[model samples]
Target chain A: MARTFEFHGGVYPPERKQRSQGPVRHAMLPGRVVLHLDQHAGRPAFATVAVGDSVKVGTPIARCDGMISAALHASISGQVTQVDRHTITIDSDGLDAWQRLTPLEWRTASAEERLTRLEHSGVVGLGGAGFPTHIKARVSERQRIDTLVVNAAECEPYITVDDLTLRQYTSDVLEGAQLIASLCGAKQIVVGIEDNKPEAISALRQAMAESQPLSVTVSVIATRYPSGGERQLIKTLLDRDVPDKGLPADIGVLCQNPGTLLAALRSVRDGEPLVERLVTLTGEAIADPGNRWVRIGTPMAALLDEAGLNRAALHQLIEGGPMMGTPLADLEGVVTKTTNCLIAATRKELPPAPPESPCIRCGACEEACPANLLPQQLHWYARAKDDAKLAHYRLFDCIECNACSYVCPSHIPLVADYRHAKTRLRHQQLETAKAEHAKHRFEWRQARLDREEAEKQARRQARLARQSTQQTDSQGASPQADLRSLRIAQTAAKAAVRKAEKNLARAAQQDPQQSHDDLETQLATAKENLQAAEARLAEARSAGEPQETP
Target chain B: MSDAFSIISLLSAVAVLTALGVGFGALLGAVSERFKGDESSLVEQIDTLLPQTQCGQCGYPGCRPYAEAINQGDAINKCPPGGDATITALADLLGRTPEPLDGEAPSEDLVAFIREDECIGCTKCIQACPVDAIIGAAKQMHTVIEDECTGCDLCLEPCPVDCIDMLPRSTPLAQWQPVTYPHQMIASDRRASMEMPHGTHL
Candidate 1:
């Protein structure tokens, strides 16, 4: 083994592997299976099959819906009974029907072919995150992958699925490693296991010896709880520290679970899709405790019944390993592709957690925390809801591995508190983002309103200017001046004509008794004068034409 | 001879005081130069503090313009989308008094949904949009980008056929947080929590 580096703060829990040492058992298919579309990270897949539709084993019920999402397949042949939110319920037909499987010959397959096959196979990080395996298989062209770390460190107490996989499927695991390395352009493959699993180590070594051209190394290190952590494992075997907020790939290494490798191998070599996986069913509450190759979507209740669980004495059921397990409230909850172990415990074997007491300020949590965070200080900041202080302390870095909670003599339920705080923080961030987005939209609206208002004002001003200019051009002179002069001239002409008519009438009256020839002649003259004045007024009105080209 | 000695002492005292003053003044000037920090970057900082709503509630056209205004002595409380939280943050950032919102919270986060049947295939609302969030061509029914809509109500007046209506965008799940909600053991949440084999903190 390469020179190992010392990590800060850890706890040594009693290892109880001897509690269940039976060979791998194959579980019978349950009456039904509930496949969650959100079994892995990223966007949830929408169901492709409707209720009452028949589906067989390896039939894709939901397509991968996102860049970082995985597809869902029917682990058993059955008819879809119900399709709820992000979940598909399939009732078993017991006929063992399956979809067509066209295996890819890994030796001759192209990189793209291998990736597509693995993607459709529905394999993920089986031991931990359950991240889509295909996404991890091909690193960016910018990154040249040189090392592949197969995590066989079953460091978590009471879980031994990887160990069995290493022992039973040794050659297949090696072959899968070879295929993964070739795809990622890796030249060195390191399999990190705890020194305790001697049998698994030897089996892997023997397989490596038989393997022709693959440069594989089995590095046995100290049995530590979180030695299997991607960062910690890399540091232990390679002595290279993965920078903060960085992935193993950042340091030219890609870490994968043994079970994932096996699944990958099966997909490429046998053209088999990942429908089922091995799950470790153990805990003192069960009659039988051992590793089992269980079908995906098998309900927890079914597994408990198979293990002969004492329902009367059951305390709490935990999913995954004890150090980092979630207390499952529903027995009806079905198994997902990521489900690796289920611990149905009684009070005697797994007692209920004690009530939390005040922190004594003892430095035990600091000593046990693998991340080197100040747990007590974090607890204080979390309770106070001090987001900045929490960030300053790197609260997001907490792995929730429960090493702090396990070592705390206060029984403070530290892990639960941290998880709650983290969730709250995430929710707060999302709210802040929405608020920011809303502000942008609102401002944009205001800007539009202002712009429109300005435009309207500008249009009104332009219209006013155009009307004024048109008035000036159309009138022979200024309209006000021309109207004033025309009115004065017309008034004078009317007064003059009226005066002449009055004179003629007077003369006719005076000569009423005598001959009226003189009066008649005067009247005719006055009429002619009036006609000439009217003509002048008409000509003045007609002359007002701005339409005439100057 | 004694009078001459006194005159020499007075000149020496004046020279000592002048030297001390010059030394301290020069030190202060150098310190100021070294730590003077960029002032133009203040615009970006203020912009970040302002909710990027692009809403002209602050009498400015967009968030960037508003940020510029704030830098030039505009009131911090004029944002409606940011409301009091934003005002308080801005005040904290700019070291000013936190004031109440200038107007009723800028209309709630909304998107303009055009009633297609009544829409005369006129793109009036599209022209009215500031962010160009509305997508459609002339004589085509227009739709708003829900995510990009600022809900400024600018589109409502321009639509010839009274077809445009402002509807509230659904509040994000995170915004629906309750007082003192600490991962309560609710029945609905129990089954939904993922099966992370390791610790729950990601």
Candidate 2:
């Protein structure tokens, strides 16, 4: 455990961790809070509470939808104000009354029971990974888990929540670690903390002494940037390499963040779900800065206001560490399970990034990249949108730690370029899939219509053939049907001739001297017309088109 | 005796030369047959370049027919629904110089919207549509299936009531994100930010 393995390139930014000076304070309750549904690293939860519904603290407002999702709870007693696609807003009543999840006795319960409670309580990795704890703690029978590594390395600058949490609840963290170890079925349990945090280390030691039966060991490694990364910490403490693109458990190791451990212990020990978390509120613009146990849905504005921050002096508001935090687009955004730190930086404290200059083909970025990827070449390919080349160089393998951006002499935002390229690539892939789907649907519909049309045309042709064959008898039937039709025609013809003769006679009587010869001609023409019709019927019968008569 | 020997050798040499010529000619013919690719694959390549809208703005019946014509050396700039991008893609595929779209490529995306009130139940449009995207019965009001409609313009002429109109389609809300313009950093902010503590910037 003494021999530490070194990872590749990293930067030594000033560890401004003075925010851990004061005792952990409770943040003032916010009047309103906005909780994002997509707090975890996977699919967002499905909303279980509708607008205008009253919810109490720890009430499940959104349940986990898919295998990778985590359930969301109401952080305070409130009325649901708004529910949008991305977020759920609640107006708090300022009441601290608790209605919690049913807790489980972890000491006596089986691992399955413990896991169910942990998942139902909505406990996730609080080290900013936001991975569901239950999923991580599960040890599949495929791999043998040997060690449970407690990650207490608060390596990022300006984040002290983990440090403070370990100091206050070391015993609880130890118990949580034991619970996770039991679940993972690991024999050896160890805590990996950076040597820089002597207070947290001693506090852990004190707790380990009290909990002798648990028998946990603590390993202290030299503090380094990104050493807090689960992979780096495992490599440093255990000298084991997690397979590329694989988890620590692949190599018989499971790493737990101290905050996650404490949360797990609380979920199991008490009948309380995870509705609040310790967030470090610090930066130059704040009047007072320290770590505080803030309710999960409390808005960043409310917390900053409590820290006596001057918004006018704010050059940038960042969420998480200085190196890897997101620039806040909305200061009113509420905290979630993964919130570890808030940096309210002034222009002087954390200056705005300068406009990028030409790359100058500098190799400093290469030396500073811990993942050892060629950042300059990647940046070029990304700008050119040469996705094929970028993929060939394994662009997705980038951890996006921003060390390359920190070391870039040109002040280029390397990580942002990578993010933009990745987004564009994803969009392109999605568009291609959509186009293929559309093409298939269009082609299938056309084929179906054409087949139907062809079938209909064939049917029409067949009917025409039949009708032409039966031209003499339109019914196209037997000899009896034809003879009967002929008889009807003959009778109609005779009736017509009789009626015409009668009319002629009446006309001659009415005007005695007027055209007696004309009346005679009209009756003669009717008799001749009937003879012509009979001849035509005989001619059609002789043509052999169809025959009903013998 | 020597003259007779010379005549026999000359006859043998000529026979060998004739046999060699016929055998090599046969080998070359076989090679040609073996290497000649199916010309229909070229048609397939051209068809793949088309957007498959089946809109027939290209003066052909469908994308497949247009692709065949292009394979037979037809102009590649006739499609408007496929537009300029399609023209360029076809040119690239065929190794031709990229030309401007013939006539005018529709500058805006269009969707066939049916004005239900003005629809006369003639069903002429339903018969005219190449994609069968219109749904109706004889003497019943017809509606366009917007998702499947290719906006071919053939339906417009047959509509007795002229109820079908091609309107510019709006972008879907799900696909929208805040536009991040590159290289738009403010000068003052840029100046203030260059105050790096070390030679390397954070």
Candidate 3:
């Protein structure tokens, strides 16, 4: 028995995992599948196929967008029906045809080749995070990893997918772990699981004995809720705390989910992409409560119907365990890589939460928190929307395990508040970054405008100086004097024309019949004189000689 | 003999006091010179707090000018684009009381959109944009770089053909956030009422 360490705070909820204890079964193929572009944690994959394109199972439908993203493959042999911004829907033709890459010998293959194969396989962390697995494995380039931790704790009650995977494919899981260990150059591998899963523990132990060359050990700890969390499991197994806002890699450790390891093995050995995963369907409202190999993009309604769902008794449908699962409002929503367990809970089995009351400062939540966070304080800060205080309390360290909420005497939704606060903090950080970018661009634009203005002013000053110097050298009168005389002549002509027009207007108003013709003649003569003076000025200017005011 | 002794003591006291005053004054002047703060950096800090929308809604030419004005005792609540958030941040940095926004706040985040076919190859918007987010040359069709655009709306009036539209920024589906508790409850309630009939088919 490998010794284990204890973490801060944990709660032992009713381990209602007996319902889904049977062997895993393959589910029937659906008539249609809707694959969302963004099933992983990073950038969404860009679609490589159009609406009318024909595709087989394992066909590369979408390519990875960036380093942190995962590629997506078609789960069913079908024709693409709709290609929208969010999802790509395919209608199956009822054939299980496949398009696969040639499998590589991982032992003989270089690390880069194995990584490329993993990238092409679209394997992600099936432990509900859906983080791309290849990026996680590539940590060996920058850091020297010493241990690989296989997370098979399966601590969340009523979710038996990992347990069943370990029981059925123990060697495959162990071999996959070895493959990752070799890739990351880790000398030791540890499988951290709960003692309640005796079957899985025994299977892992038997496999460990058979794999003599690989250094692998099974560490079975007491079953506790949220012990499956990456940080908690690492803490329990190695007594090492992942630094705040740091990753397992920072501590020279790499933690990979069992399902993700199995998927990577299949991708490198069988030339298969991640087309399906083991899903646990169990609740009071389910007639056949067990695990099944459900294809990605299978609709919730179809999967539930296959499990013999009790529609009238089903009050709420959750996508994960009852502790930290999200309730499903749309039955038509399809399952993605992160959908691990489905719980069609009845009203009595999982009743709606009561309305929240003010906190009594009982400190039960603090005692039950697995991450050692002060849930009551976080709740107050979240309610007040005090982002600074929430950050000061280290709100980002919260894993949203719902242990605190479960043990709260007042029935406070502590995890929900923490999730909201975390999202708001992330949003605030993004806004600040954007503001900084905008400030940079604004400053650059201002500097450019100032430079342009300075250049224009310099050019104008140079032209004035050059003109003055040219006039002094070539002519007796400077251009400044010439310009002054021209301005005086033009003003005098404009005043004479105005006087003539006013006189004509006055004569017309007094006695229009007698004096209108005489004033009109005077006005015409003044206009002619003005035109003659402007023509002389223009001729002199065009001749490049100074013009005298008339 | 008593008068001579008293005069000598008074003169000695005056000389000692003058020496102490001169020495302390020299020390104070050196310390003040060495520790003098940069005045422009204060403006830079204030400018960082203000949103760089450059919308001219704050009655200044840009965010930097407004930041300078704020440092020069101008009211901090006049920015509509930065709105209350900027005011609170400025108050925190300047150690002043936060005030309510002085003008109408923008109803939503807006990005400028140009109807391309109606652009008529005019470059008016390109010149009007403060951040140079719009790309075009004279007598060439202009377009807004959506990511670079700060949504200042300074280019709206510059369009000759009235082709520019200030539309609310559209969030991509990938960026859509999950609904929090209160909103989630409301959504479930509405779903229950509407999906009851659909449930029967199952």
TM-score of each: 0.74, 0.74, 0.83
Which candidate, 1 or 3, has the higher lDDT? Answer: 3
DockQ of 3: 0.16
Best by lDDT: 3
lDDT digits (tens) for residues A1-550 of candidate 1: 4456667777777776766668888887788988888888666776799999999999988888766778788888989999997689999999988885687778888999999988887778898688988878867444778899999988888888899999999999989999999889888888999988888998988898876467888898889878887887888888888887777888999998999999999988887788889998887788888888888888889888988887887766888878886668768688787888887867666655544567899989998888878999998888888889989988988888788888778766677678778888887676556545555444434434544554454455445545756777544342322645656755775676577678767765653334444344444444444444444444444443333445
The model with the greater TM-score, 1 or 3, is: 3
DockQ-derived CAPRI band for the predicted complex in model 2: incorrect
Query: Residue A20: error of model 1 in Å?
Result: 3.5
Tens digit of lDDT per residue, candidate 2, span B2-42? 99999999999999999999999999999999999778999
Select the stronger candidate by DockQ from 1 and 3.
3
TM-score value, chain A, candidate 1:
0.82
Model 2 CA deviation exceeding 4 Å by range: A107-119, A133-151, A177-192, A205-219, A230-256, A268-271, A450-550, B1-56, B59-96, B103-178, B182-202
- Cα lDDT of model 1 overall? 0.77
Q: Model 2 over residues A357-378: C-alpha lDDT tens digits? A: 7899869999887776899999
What is the C-alpha lDDT profile of model 3 across B121-183, one tens digit per residue? Answer: 778888889877899777778888887788999998877789999888887553466564343
Q: Which candidate is the best by TM-score?
A: 3
**After superposition, which runs of candidate 1 have C-alpha atoms over 4 Å from their true positions?**
A1-3, A435-550, B1-40, B53-69, B74-84, B99-202
True contacts kept of each: 0.20, 0.09, 0.22
User: DockQ winner among the candidates?
Assistant: 2
